[model samples]
Target: MTPSAIILIVLGLAAIGYVLGRQRALKTAQREGVKLHSLSGYHGQSVALFIAVPALFLLAAWLFLQPVLIESSVSGRIPQSAIPEGGARSLVMFDVRRIAEGLNQIVAGGDVSENDLADMRADVTDVRARLAEVGVALGSDVSPIVLQTAKEYRATDLTASFVRNIAVLVVALGFGAWALARIRPGLRARNISETFIKALLMGSSLVAILTTVGIVGSLLFESISFFNMYPAKEFFLSTTWNPQFRGGSELGILPLLWGTLYVSFVALALAVPLGLMIAIYLAEYAGSRLRSYAKPAIEVLAGIPTIVYGLFALITVGPFLRDWIAQPLGLGSSSSSVMTAGLVMGIMLIPFISSLSDDIINSVPQAMRDGSYGLGATKSETIKQVILPAALPGIVGAFLLAASRAIGETMIVVMGAGASAQLDLNPFEAMTTITVKIVSQLTGDTEFASPETLVAFALGLTLFVFTLGLNILALYIVRKYREQYE
Candidate 1:
């Protein structure tokens, strides 16, 4: 039976349990001539919760664990010789899973008999072609060991799925019957149902917390592995960034860090002033009619995909700067440069800063502005002396948020800034950031056992730390001054 079928059956049982439980509660109350602890509806809810929650939880756990346990058992049966040279066992298992799925599909389509499929051998039959006929594309011809393992995997998975469906239904029926038997005037059904709902809410909250812990743990563990293979001091301090798959690579963070900071600095320089001006005009000076139209139009930039901005930087801005400005002035000739990426990234960040700053400026109390004006201050003076100071903390937060966005951007850097990792001071010369190298290092048929590939995790950890620091600083600034303003 399918999981969906099991779920439907469980739900049907829950519905029946609800009706019976409610009736039992009502009859007991009437017959005993006593006040019920909870409403009939609460008794019904308690029955449904008992029937559904534990069964569903068991079903979810089984679905998650079955493949993991089956894969572990099946993978253990495959000989080490079956794995290709310098290739992972995981890759072989991937192929095994694919072939198993394909065989299942072929059987389901009625193109192959179960007995015939079981008797087939990789050496005797064209396994790849047979799978392809059913729309499963294998990369290469299957070997005998892989074929046998796939069959085993398929059989094991099918048996597990059948058992899972049976177990889930049995659990649902068992819990439901017990709940119905316990239904009475003094059952306190409302308390039991409410407790289950509260536990569910807590579980929901823990999902996000657990997810964050998992990400950090994975990065930390992989980074430690990388640091063991490569010197941590050199990774952090060396100025060059180069990685060769064949070994003797210089994996450095300084060049990437410099490029990231340089581009972000250039971007913030352009975005901050312009966005602040826009925010000031919109919040303090612009007419309501103009503000309504102008604000959304400006914010439209935020909705545009970063890839679009990257393409814009690549096709238009990069060439324009290279031809008209860089070549004429002899600053640099390359189209893909720090300046190109920085400018385009700045344009992308404008809406973020402007929108946030506008809200922050608008949030400043009117009394502050009135006090400045009453003290013989002009409108501009009131804005500079009163409103700006009041909104400073939030405006700082907006700037940091824009900085974080700029630091993490990948596509814009890839398209606008050429992948040359160096410490050159020239803005027009191409350079790459940590994110770009992280992508490049992890791409293609790379082995995770090597320091070169594992370095991606180290780079990722560094980026995470840097961004986390920025967030912390933003929070600190906000908290330090927020109370004074409030």
Candidate 2:
């Protein structure tokens, strides 16, 4: 049977099994004079999953193994003169499959050009005739034992998939029907389902924990390597930013730390006020018509790709700042300065702050707002004093999230921030960031053993630690503040 037919049969059988299972379960419950174990849909779903999951798993396993097993068997049949070594065997197998599929299409189809039709007709006829000739020739030229083994290998594979499909249908339907018939009042179906679901949930949770461990392990190893070359004190305390390419590289952490802080501060400086005002206007002041139209419009900012923001910083904001603000203020020579990337990144984060703050503000109970009004507070006064404080911790969380985003932002910094690792305080002057250095040191013909490449890992570790600390702090603040409100 074809693959598509197998799939349809499996699905159709599973669906029928589900319906029958649910009906049988309900009838058994009535006959036994006991309450149904679960909702009708859950009964149906339990049976459907029981039928479908094992069958699908079997099908998937067969599909994955079929290709590898077939390739190995086919590779053995091809003469040694055709190819040597397994290095090119995989590629040749792919081409052979395509050639066989193309021939099948030629034999099956009729609407072809006169020239192409003639060629395809000849090709299919020749292949079929050659295949038959090869079968007969193999029996004679090859040793009987070898010929028998080869034919058995090919024939077994041909029926293997068909057998698997049949097995899938029989096992799934038989087990699902038997299980459904056992679903009486005291069977603990819900408990069993919940246990399965809990396992799934636990499996998902492990992924997050494993990811964190991997990051920490990578950083811990690289930082240990870095400390072997540079002392821990200098890396943490030195103010200078220069890391020498040759022997003079001073691996200090202070300069990059300063740049990270400065850029994060600048982003917050731009994002906070605008985002807060937008939130306030949307939540407290805007009419229903305007609110309906405006919220998604603001959310559109979030969907603009970060690469677009990088280009905006490089091509638009960088040049404008250079031509407008930097020239007028006599700040620096380059337009792509600390401020350019920060400002662009700030724009990118506005949606994040506004949407989160808006949710928190809106979540402030209506009773609180009514109480403030009853006390004679104006609309703005209620929001400023009562609602704002109530939502402060959540807003602070949003701020920390935005700050983390700014600190970790890559494309904008790589394109817009200057590469000079400077300690200068001027926001208009050219400056480089930790992320930019990470990208630079790790890319472009890097040697894994060299300090230059290893330093990127160290920098990455620092960034991870910094972000983790911020998230922990945010959670603490939110928890403490939530207690007061509760």
Candidate 3:
């Protein structure tokens, strides 16, 4: 049975147990002529928790383990000679899995029986033609060893899936019966249900923590592999960014880092003042109807996909800057320039900063404004001296967040800021950021094990660290200033 089917079945059983448990609790209370300690719903919840939770846990654990076990078991059966030239065992395994799935499809379509599939040999039978008929195209005809390995892969996987379904049902029935038997007037059903709920909440919380750890671990592992192939110092400190698939590439980060910072600086320079002014006007000066209409309209920019923004930069913004400003100044004639990307990105960031700052500014006590007025200060003076200081930390945090967003942007940079990794001071000159190069370096016609491809991971790790640092600094500032205000 499929995992979804098993889940639905278990839930069905849990629903039945809920009805049974609730009815049983009410019967026991009425038969004993005593009041129940908890509500009937709590009794039903305790039974349902037992029926579903353990069964779901087992299903999840089995799903995670089954693939690893199957892969290990099947990998050992294929000989080293079966692996293609310049390819790892992993690549062969991918083919083996595809073949296995194709065989399953063939059986399901009644093109082959279970016995016929088991008895078939690639050398004696037209396995490739049969698989192809089912839309599983292979690059080459099936070899005997791969066919046998694929057969083994299918057998083990099917067995594991079958066992998983049976085990989940048994667990659901067993745990559910055990819980229902213990349901009585003094069973503390409410506490048991709450404890189970708390445990689920804790698991949900761990998912985020575990997810962060997994991301860091994967980046670190791939980065370590990259550093082993390329020097760490060269990657971090060198002044160029060039990757040649044929080896001896100048994989420097200085130029990319400079462009990232330059573009981000330009973006922030445009966004921060404009966004803050918009936020201040909206929060303090705009009427309620205007604020409601205007805030959502400004925030609508956030809903537009980055690719759409990229198209805008490419078609509209890039040409405008190149013709009007860059060409006139004799800076550069390229449509793709840092100034074009920065301006578009700043427009993208405006909503992020303005929304957050608006909330923070509005959160300031109105009594502070009244106190300034009582002290005979003008409106502008009150805002300049009292309100802005109180809201500064949060505003700074919003800027940092917007800066991270700008730094990580890929499409706008690619469309507006041309893919030239250079350290020029002119904003009209074509330049690129780390993210744009990371995409370009890792994409297409490259070996995964090669330094060029692995360098993407290193770039990603660096970006993650930089963004993480920004987040930490923002959190620290917010915490420190918030405590003072509170």
Candidate 4:
């Protein structure tokens, strides 16, 4: 049976056990002529947890370990000479897995009978041509060693899956019966359920923490490799950004960082005031009817994909800015410029700031506004003095969030702002951000041994630090102000 089907069967038995456990609890209480200690459902839930949790954990562990064990067992069977020049042993194993899976597909379709497959030989059956008929493409003729190893891989995996199914079912049923036998009226089923829930919550929290740690560790590892190949000081200090795959390429973060900051600054310059005012008008002045229609309309901008925004900037805004403003003013006449991407990105960020600030402003107490009115302050004055101060922490967080988004933007910067790394301050001049440069450096057929390719990781790590700092500062400000208000 399939692993998924086996899991479903185990769960079905557990569900039956729950019903029996609940009935048993009720019967024991009635027979003893006493009130139950806890609800009948808790007793049933305890039985279900005992039945399902251990078995499900086993299933998960089996699934995780099965591939590793199969790879180890199968790869050891092939001769070391089977690996081609400039290729890894793992690459040969990859082909083994693909071929094994493809052969299974053919057998399942009845194109190859079980008896024929058991007696098959690559030399006699023309294995490559047969595999092709089954839609499995191979680069070259299948070798005898590879075919034999693939057949073993398929058989071993099948046997292991069968064993796993039996083991899981046995554990599920065994623990389920034991739990049912232990279900007395005085059993602390409620406490058991609560403990189970708490452990599940902790496991979920750890998954998130582990995910962050894993990301940082990968970046740090690759960045270290990059630094070993290229000097760390020059990577950070040199002003030019030229990457030559041949060798001795001038790779520096300064120009990309400058362009990123410059574009972000222009974005914030346009976004902050407009988004803030929109939030203010929606939260403070607009009626419920107007806000209902307007808020969703504005939020619709956030739903539109960034690629669409890039297209808008490339076709509409870039040309409009270059022809009318840049050329007319004798500034740089490039259609793709810092100004074009910044303006488009700012428009994209408007909904984020406006939505967040609106919520923060609405959270301010009515009593504070009333107190300001009692002091003969006008509505605008009350909003500025009483409401804004209270919402300042959340507002600052909103702005920082927008800034992170702008710094990390790729599509708009790639298409709207041309891919030239420059430290110039002129907004009309073409420039590229850290993200765009990362894409450019990593694209196409390349070897990871070169500094040209590895430098992308160094660039990524630096960008990660900058955005992480922005988020941390934003959170700190929000917490400090919240504590002060409370």
Compare the candidates by TM-score and give the number of the best one: 3
Angstrom error at residue 476, model 2: 3.0
lDDT of each: 0.92, 0.75, 0.91, 0.91
Write candidate 1's Cα lDDT for 105-132 as tens digits: 9899996799999999999999999999
- Scored by lDDT, model 1 comes in at 0.92
Against the true structure, candidate 3 reaches a TM-score of 0.96
Separate clash counts for every candidate:
0, 1, 0, 0
Q: How do these models rank on TM-score, best leading? A: 3, 1, 4, 2
Residue-wise C-alpha lDDT for candidate 2, range 1-486, written one tens digit per residue: 776787787788778877876787778778888887676556766677677766776787788788688767776775554444543645444445544444334434654433543343321344444334333221112222232333344445557767877887787777687767777766666666677567657867987998889879988998789777677787788877665556566767777777778877888899998998899999999998998889989999999988999999999999999999998899987977889988998898899899989888988889999999999999999999999999999899888888888899888877777787778788988788889888877784645556767778788888998888888887887677667656
TM-score of each: 0.94, 0.66, 0.96, 0.93
Local error of candidate 4 at residue 350 (angstroms): 1.0
Worst 10 residues of 1 by lDDT: 477-486
For model 4, residues 1-486, the per-residue Cα lDDT tens digits are: 888898898789889988988999999999988777789999999889888888998998899899999899889988988989998888899989888988898898887787788788878888888888888988888888888899999999989999999999999999999999988888888998899888878978988999999999998999999999999999999999988757879998999999999999998999989999999999999999999999999999999999999999999999999999999999987999999999999999999999999998998889999999999999999999999989999999999989988999999999999999989989999999999988987893567668888788888999999999999998898777667646
Candidate that beats the other on lDDT, 1 or 3, i.e. the better one = 1
On a 0 to 100 scale, what is the lDDT of residue 278 in model 3? 93
Q: Write the per-residue lDDT of candidate 3 for residues 1-486, one digit (tens) a residue.
A: 789999999999999999999999999999988889999889999999999999999999899999998999889888989988977999889889999999999999986799999999999998889889999998888899999999999999998899899999999999999999988887899999999999999999999999999999999999999999999999999998888879889899889999999989998999999999999999988999999999999999888888888899999999998899889989889998888899989999999999999998998899999999999999789988999999999899888889888889998898889899998999999999999988888785888888898888999999999998998898887777678656
As a whole number from 0 to 100, the lDDT of residue 433 in candidate 4 is: 92
Worst 10 residues of 4 by lDDT: 477-486
User: Which residue runs does candidate 2 get wrong by more than 4 Å?
Assistant: 1-190, 243-248, 482-486
Q: State the displacement of the C-alpha of residue 166, model 2, in Å, after optimal TM-score superposition.
A: 15
Candidate 2 residue pairs in backbone clash: 244-249
